[model samples]
Target: MSRPFADGEGKVGTWVNEFKENQDVTYACLRPVQTTVLGKTAKVYLTPFSLNDYKLEQLKHSKSLSEKNSNYMMVCQKSEPKKTCEEILIPKMKVIPSKAESTLQKLSLGVHDESNKPGHKSPSAAAILSADMESSDEDITPGVDDFSGLSPYEKKRLKNISENAKFFASLQLSEVSARLREMIKKRQPPKSKRKKPKKRENEIGCRRSMRLLKVSPSGVSLPAPPTAPMLIEDENPLLPPGPLEMIPENADDNHELFKGFLQTWAEMNKTSSKNMEEELSSLKSYKANLNGMVISEDNVHKVTKGSISSVALHPSETRILVAAGSKLGQIGLWDLTQQHKEDGTYVFYVHSQPISCLYFSPANPAHLLSLSYDGTLRCGDFSRAVFDEVYRNESRSLSSFDFLAESAATLLVGHWDGALSLVDRRTPGTSYEKLISSSMTKIRTVHIHPVQRQYFITAGLRDTHVYDARYLNPRRSQPLVSVTEHTKSIASAYFSPVTGNRVVSTCADCKLRIFDSSCVSSQMPLLTSIRHNTITGRWLTRFQAVWDPKQEDCVIVGSMAHPRRVEVFHETGKGVHSLLGEGLGSVCSINAMHPTRYVLAGGNSSGRLHIFMKPGSY
Candidate 1:
């Protein structure tokens, strides 16, 4: 959705005028605006890609207060597809001068630029980082005397003016101080000695005489030598021998010494509250990533059990069907919003192996299909996955499976053999034919054109391909365009639901790319490419790229990498948001169920099918 224009196109003017322009954008926020460390001075504005998205945000689920703590945006995806030597060479070889890549190269370079406080890394950002590093150094930690860089006056001004800033950095020192004290409190005090009290000689002598009389009365008789008090030597004054007196309770009632401590304590309290809120949000994000099962409208039918491979709803009605996996390999069906099944609830097991991919017909929601790695494609008849004897084939392993939305006779499959095949699955009770077999070297996912029945796109393990599926007859399928900007294997790709001509892809190289077919011929052309990242807990795998049905340009993608990320990228590929996923697990597969809404089903070797769905509308 990037409408890349020649730079310097918009004239700077008043805010209202800027807002009214035909092609206007909110000022490109490089970063979020923040007050200085003590909130006294304004440093710069920052646009941060807050890592607090993808959590449960349904009406019933209250808005998380932690989300407010996230103060960043404009996340950059990693390296996107680049014009490869192959793509670049083709146009030049044909004597058709390709558009000079200077512009695109510049744009791409800018997207990857670390020059300022924008994208992932920026100069100002780096400066802030250096400041942080210096502050954290054990040898240089700021204290009462560490004034290596600041003039005494500047330091005093910083303390006086920005000391009361409500934001975080303003009270960092105080917060740290409180934390230190907390740690110190965890330690027990060492034992100490006090001075022994002295007595007068006469008092000592009288005490001795009493002792002798008492001893003699007890009949223990040893005559005391002179019965006089012995002289005592002066003990070292520095060596403590007795209890030290407590300082007076009201000694120096001035509270200045504790002002900083109290400030720190307050800051620590604020930080703790913020942390608790974040923990709660993280918990919700965790649930959102794997919440594939939902109660039927009537709440009578429950979709549960082994990992759910797919969830589908009737195209026009309230009927829903769920395909799940079990140790015994079973797929279940539930009548959501309906209670008229001849059987109270229908359950069926039609495969001996775990279900790999499943889908319901766009034409008739009740009708569905299932494909397994076991080399089988099973069609469904409302209640169960009945064998479609007509379209079965076992030539190679099937990695992905789906039916074209048009009541067409085609089924698309990406195989382990690194080939993509569009099988004519119209007939179901007999042996079938190989409609079309095309290879992409390393294939990961294959799906039909949302609006163009004639074309289909294949996200290869390393590249992206657009094929003319109408040619599945061998006479029709031919390459429309091939994109190889990604240097690594592409894990997922999606054509914009609204803009069929535009495509987006994510790859192992940690990049997200956006392109339009119309501009594909422009040589160095693409709407845009983004390269920032989130979802940093796992290795990225089986991914699904999707467009927001409501806001056409909004997009979301699931990551298979550690701390699997469900990132949202804007249509222009300029904006980004990283959300939480089930766990650090590889994503097996992903697909969109509707234009505005979608369902995600993926699992790792852990046997848990992680399902993410938009909460309410679906």
Candidate 2:
């Protein structure tokens, strides 16, 4: 019921009235309508006549249409055909100016005119309009401004744009913006030069402790006793201890001199023993009187060559004998009471590596024990004037050792490979009584409970554990209590010196933690965690927090803070005192307190010893 009409140009269109029911329709004559397209006016003819009539009209115009179709088909084929300019009918287009074009014309003319003025169009604008209408399409060129053709509105707009450009140029904002961009680029690193993350390989096997390996016992040998050189009256009195020398050929005369030295050391052991009642009373009444202590020039001395790794105070009340060990495997013994005699110091090369621990036997002050990373534990016997080898392990290096009972012969030693060995000096061979593997990677420190001698604690990596000596299994011993809140490697852990009711630890996370161990169980509650800097870099020894032997509630540790002082804090995280002096200008990484005296000693990385005591106590 519908029909489509096609014009002479072959554009088909639908007639809307074709769908009506009325059939009485009359044909209308052709007419033209005026319409504008693409800024050009043209006439379009529309006829609703019969299809036969439409075909007849198309036939009449076939000649002209064929020529136009041929040209269009050539263009579609991507080919150009030469034609005379008279045959090409170019449509007349109306010119409409844009704001940018008008403004550009004003800028080219370098003039400004008021748009609000009442008058006819400017003569210059009229001239440019006439020229644009008369110009041919082929004759027009781009980027050519008509300087003489600008209206008042365009001239005003051009004036405003020029003023803004001049203002910005005076401010020099473009140069400042360029410099800021350059600075930003320099501050940020380029993506191409950034470091790429390393790919981690899959671990193949589980880690096994070195103690589990089966190996033969290491050979143990005793070297000749080291002897000090005789001092001459004319020698420099402030000189350090001379190197050890071989005994003279006259062994008998040398033996006599050694015996006299032993006798004098015995006479210096004048510590009076107290009963349990008096000892408990004294401990309860002990207070840290830090204000009364002073560090003077006379109390400071260089005891060793390399950094001091460990320090121990002798328990003799009649004399002040401080012993220190260095990373260079040297042991220095300083006698403060005999400062005027031979410089009051003696240095001995006893080990081949760094000494990790030093302690004078409490049962007999004559025997001083020292452990070194060279896998050897030696005892300096003043009575015999010899360093006797007590234990050695060639398979693994020793890390820490402590006395297990009142008798100093029984010892508990920890290895770098997470193994614990029970050693008895009375035994003949280099073998241990019992060896047990632990659940740690490296045992950094070990401490036996003061009252409960059978209980001990070990610190390694990021964990600290307490174990009982009676239930240790040879394969894998279980811990009685474990403290795992440490976020970094634990430097050291120790029990209270008097009652063993609390444990204090120093961690590389810059925190000092204390645990209440009044009743040892699987869960030991954390008492306090104090924010203290414990990060001693590679060139210095690690900081360790140790308890005051006289006061069970107080703890002492070296500081990395300015003014180079040592800090003492109570168990509740309150600062008790900070020992500062002009003579102490370096970080004291290792510190120790006298067991029965009011004396404290700190050792620095430069091997210097600083002593703090009552001004006239020495």
Candidate 3:
């Protein structure tokens, strides 16, 4: 038997042997058409049919013989026709000639290879030459030899180039283009000579503090002694030697001058006190008096080296003495009465950190007490011309302090860690008299009640708390009155200076709250909540609302509004007066009012002091 094979016309056939019952052997032809074999579609061609009697007998018995046979083509199997044609014959590979070879052949056939010729030009250059030689006619045609060796794309590109050249020649732009090229070449900026950057010295590493560098595992080392001082004549011959000394050469004379100032300060404070009943009755007139106060050129002065953190007024009604403390721990004393003498200003470095509080002793007006974040509380004893360490807690920084007793010898101090310390000046040591722990995270301000000496209020975190001094315990002590309405941290809180009947608080939520505290044993009811801008950004000190010590019915607070001014608001949530002046440009974050005088002093972040007082009152 022959193996199956496909013809050139896409036809396939096979030959097989037939089995006959008559014992006769013959060849049988199997014809094929488009049909499915197993599962795949296949194209088939049929050969001439030759069947034996046995096959004819089998066909006669087949059931499909009754159906019509189309041109004797039998369908063996059926399947769905494919959408695409499937080639049964292998495709012949067609060889394509190389473009370079064809082009070379074409050039060899009488066309010259112009690319290598010295006199030959590019297609674009040739086009420009032809455009210069030919007339401007749309129908102008070039010789067939010009483009015979080029592709259709190259020929079209040459035609486009030639047309562009003709258009430029018609516009007479060739000379202009040449002139523009010449001008561009002539106007080209000269290359700047860049100086080679000097190789920088190795960047200096950050210098650590001398104190830190001197520390060792065994113990801290003290700083080395200073070198000998240079003579004034050697340093600057024009400068006077006496003023150049850190310690004045005429120390005795300076001491005498300071002693005389102290004596004058004591004598001014000796003025008799006014009747309390009469002053309290004149509270309305006092508010009116504040309204009429004016800020003059002499009233504003730069008193410290940095932002003022605390301010105080001397308890002298006969003279205007203002003391201010700065964030850099400098204390400035300004006397309005002697403004003509060296601007009446004296500065002293009293602490190593920001001064948190400054107060003049009511009992000894000459002694000015100052508290600092350096964990030191000192009194500027004018009589002794020294800063006496009243109390010191090296473990924690002091936030604020207030006199606890009328004698001004007992002090109540608040620590940054929300602890309280009671200090007595008469005690021999610098340690606190008593230390009380608190649950608050921080204590921003502390104020003692004027009438009720045993009661005091503290403002910090998100609440203001009032505590009874006698009942305070280290283990646990409950607040007598907790003002909890503040949604944010409270900056400062103070009791009415004379009667302690009202409490004024400033909060980070931009509100000024006044509480009625006449009945101190119970919760203080919120009397008024006035909207105010208390947001002083990181560089400025926080705004604190304080009370007019002379007027119990009004409160004084710094304002952040434009046309910068300090505001005095009544306890009933009404604006009493807005103190504005020409020299008061910045927000006065810290302010103080004289106890018995009609004087108001505001301290700004730049360490300047602005005072407003009735004409000639200061």
Candidate 4:
């Protein structure tokens, strides 16, 4: 029922006129009513257009369409193209001259200075050197023409000079010129001219005028002209020409010598001073009631299969993730917030032997790392859901490892055969450097300084070694510093996390040592040494003293005697706190602290993890 509309006109009504044809529907032109009546209004109508008027309207509409099309076409023709770099940048660039290239060209051309010209008399070597030394340019002339008629020795010297100039031109201009001047000065012969003392004119005049006094006829001397008194002692003395000998003299000994009495005064007071500090700490702990309360506990294995060797907490304590490794090489991860057996736990079986250490990456809290006695180190990234084998060895066993927090990419790994290696995560198969020694029976642990990332401390058979990571080469046989104070095997040694002002070590000799590490270049004074009971049962796990990240002055360690507890001691040999009573149900052998929060995690021999937060936090 619909027809397509035309562009020129739309017809909705039909009309038949004198010169027109009839149509089905034609459009009616509208006009306003000229007048209106009250109560009944007449319908409005429009006057039909004549032929002339219709023609005029059509011309006007056509004229407007032509003007718009012309304008559009003109604009399209006038547009400019986009400019490019070839037109703008090429003209602005200027050529720059290189100093090295110019110098090399000059040396190859064999140019000579004015001093070495054929017509001019050749100056002495010292004079030529002095003149050229004052100039900015370091170019040397070899006098090539003079060499044609000279002896072979002189020709050799000129050839050397030419070669030297070429060598200097090839190096960095600034540094090479300074070094060349120093070498030239050292090669020059010493000057033979000494500064002649100014002659005394008055004395010469006196001698000339009184020449007749020398032949005194009557044995009488003529009166000498009055002269000024010379200060013989005030004149500068001549320095010895050659090396001065340090001749020993038998001068009088005024030192007060102490007769054969052994210096036991210092040794006698050292023991008494240490005992006094221990008694003081005991009194402080009794009055302060220092104790920690546990908030929760989680079991690594449902039926307690094997002892738990290590435990680690994520850096971010928001959603706590407790990862513990067991003696049978099984690693269990639990979401502490969920606390369910099946739904909240994830287990990994990566090693064939027992696990030695477990830790979370400092750079990423979701990444976990584990080391085992089977000589394998592995990393698991939860974000990517992939496992990566970081390192492996067929002969040596990996015991423990620590990440360099500063680099966030390097790891220091210790082995059972007294070997240490620095492994980069990006290149896991090859080690960057390795250290080994015959005297080192076993490497127990390796700890990097918290503040100085370039240095690390290690505990071996009965000694501790400190090394600079930058200078550690495979062929180097010595460490930067060594500490040998324990009789039995040393368990672990660490620098203080805050300020790195002190070092604390736990040894199997039943002793804990504190040293002043504030200045490593000087002697490290032993601040205090305390008797600790480290003897557990034959098959028990060895206890290690770990520094609390929150407090630099206090350290926490497990107890092997009496009630089941973990004790904390001040660096000054004072007791800080004790986790005793029903709060801690079993003995804890391995522990770690939350980096930024007041929370602690511990593990026991029965495959369990114990968590303790601040008292008010629970």
Candidate scoring better on lDDT of 1 and 4: 4
**Top-TM-score candidate index:** 3
| Model 4: how far residue 412 lies from native, Å | 1.6
Residues 127-166 of candidate 1 have per-residue lDDT tens digits of 2211211111112113413333443322222222111121
Q: In model 4, which runs have C-alpha deviations exceeding 4 angstroms?
A: 1-292, 296-304, 339-342, 428-439, 615-618
Off by over 4 Å in 2: 1-263, 276-288, 429-431
Instruction: Please list the C-alpha lDDT of all candidates, in the order they appear.
Output: 0.43, 0.68, 0.67, 0.56
Look at candidate 3 and tell me the lDDT of residue 28: 16
Top-scoring candidate (lDDT): 2
Residue range with the least summed lDDT across 10 consecutive positions in model 4: 29-38
> In candidate 3, which residue ranges exceed 4 Å CA deviation?
1-263, 266-271, 277-284, 339-343
Model 1 TM: 0.42
* lDDT of candidate 3 at residue 9, scale 0 to 100: 26
What would the per-residue lDDT of candidate 3 be over residues 437-556, giving only the tens digit for each residue?
866778999999989999999998998889999998987677887778999989999999888999999999999999999999988999999999999999999999998876888889
Clashing pairs in 3: 12-45
- How many clashing pairs in candidate 2? 0
Residue 134 CA displacement from its true place in model 3, Å: 72
Give the candidate order by descending TM-score: 3, 2, 4, 1
Q: Candidates' TM-scores?
A: 0.42, 0.59, 0.61, 0.51
